[model samples]
Target: MTVWDRPEPPARPVPLDRERIVAAAIALADEGGLEAVSLRKVAARLNAGPMRLYGYISAKQELFDLMTDEVYAEILPEERPCEWREALRVLAHRTRRAALRHEWLADLLGGRPSLGPNGLAVTEAKLAALHGLADIDTVLRAVETVSSYATGAIRREIASRRAERATGLSERDWQRASGAHVTRMLATGRFPALASAVHDGADVDAETTFATGLEWVLDAVAARLTRPPA
Candidate 1:
């Protein structure tokens, strides 16, 4: 066909990249949940075919990894603390806050090794905070311990929040009033320590509980450190 008669090439498809793919996946997860995210759904969100996504992510798990790393960017501190303890504490809190914001993160936090750029940056920050405090082994152990606590805490917090939403009751109310079975069990005195804790323990908010537990973990780490934080 002559140049003038030739059909114009179809408009170029909107640019696609890892960022866009991950963003679409994250949006899907946020609206529904991780289970809601799929390559077809993400591709649909981007006005592309599912096969097109293969160029950016080979599998669903890879998409999840990208989403997790993207969230890690939010966990990176704006200004890292100078003190190692404060640095670790900040990282833990920021990670918790990030998980809270992206509730699906509870499902994926520490699920896999984070090798993405942003993820590595987070690890580097944590390691840098304890650069000279001890031998490499000890530092690695401290980081892993603190990270494990934070991951477990965040997951529990998310699970509790989900339970609260499902029951339309706060945790304490759910435990104390939602079930007569619990009350009967508590009164049986078979579990004296449990009963006492349930009846007499001060009811603290989730943030306070998390912070207190984190401090305890930090204290334990401090005890093991070869050099104390300045």
Candidate 2:
């Protein structure tokens, strides 16, 4: 076939862009966690030279930032709720869902400022939820508090799941956390609170635990907003 008759190499795969690069990286992260994602791997996934991605993403952190912004898209509700409480609740739950979908997200959540468009939008929605309901400082604190809780909760949940998978035992097992070490610690009777928690505490669902903690944090915020200014 002549040069003109050839397929033009399928238009060079539509020229890699930031969106495509982030997508490829996210796919790799989804399969094997953040540690598995690298510029070389993403380039291979896209069938392009590794240098090609550099034109769009200067560094690996930028790629991770982009991936995080993409996740913020999931955190924004389709139709925002009217009440501030509901709005905050929706945002928290959505963030948790996003983490579950991309478990590696737990590593980056709240790790750095998200300056991308989507990340800015998520922050806007969070602050807007209480636009006129409270003072700016209070609102900022509330949003930060919720975000911190979500970040920690998701990280802990992922760690728990990983530990469970590494060991054959379910989280309900008596020795899930440290196996024989924890069992032995409990046996010593040196720490009553720790022993009681390990023995008497009911096994609660992760989602329930997260929601319960979030509600408590929100309650504190609510009190701050409603109370007369000191």
Candidate 3:
């Protein structure tokens, strides 16, 4: 077919909504590091100019905010079960999954809260789940506690991954960190508690440490719930 007979190669559709642009940005961020995401990159992905992206998203920060909300939007919302422990367990797993799925999410999560509708929806869901606490102070503390745990877990995971990449170390090699080094220090038997703990096997695991801390926080929240109203 001649160039003109090709019927202009079928014009591709253009996205006109913020959701579409933000979705594109999310996909871009997922495949590449956050630094690889930019108006220019997104535009090129969409086969448009950088200025066209601004039409849908005002600034890169706005794009990031939208992407952040999109990640939170993945949180599954079920009416919190009757037991607070069950609710917390579900929420923690959901948050962990979202963070693990999106590598850039930990930083986005701890940054300024997004006021977008999707973000507000997630916040409202969390508040409602903790509404049984009835005390504003307790409720706020519970929210903050769980959120910090989730973010801290994700942050540690990311840091560990980065450290491994930088040092060309694998998990097997990771044991070398406090392995022989700390083990030898404890082997001196200067402190009975240290010796006992080392003999009992005191290996550190990111997942185990995270779950232990999360369980402790939830237990604290449960204690607060049972406390008599002042």
Using lDDT as the measure, which candidate wins? 1
Q: Report every candidate's CA lDDT.
A: 0.87, 0.84, 0.74
Model 2 misplacement above 4 A: 1-14, 173-184
Candidate 1 backbone collisions, by pair: none
Please, what's the RMSD in Å of model 2?
Answer: 6.8
Candidate 3, after superposition: displacement of residue 177 in Å? 6.7
TM-score, each model?
A: 0.90, 0.88, 0.81
Q: How do all the candidates rank in terms of lDDT, highest first?
A: 1, 2, 3
Residue-wise C-alpha lDDT for candidate 3, range 1-230, written one tens digit per residue: 21112222223366445666677788988877688789888888777777766555666887787788778777755565666677766777777778778888876876776686667777776777778566877898888888888888878888787778888888678766659887777767777787787578667777777788888888888888888888
Ranking by TM-score: 1, 2, 3
Evaluation by lDDT, superior candidate among 1 and 2? 1
- Please report how far candidate 3 places residue 57 from its true position, in Å: 1.5
Clashes of 1: 0
Over the stretch 1-230, how does candidate 2's per-residue lDDT look in tens digits? 22112232223554876668889999999999999999999999988999877666667887888898888898888899989999999999988999899989988887677887788888999999999987899899989998898889999998888777787678768355567897887788898898888789987899999999999989988988899978
lDDT value, candidate 3, whole model: 0.74
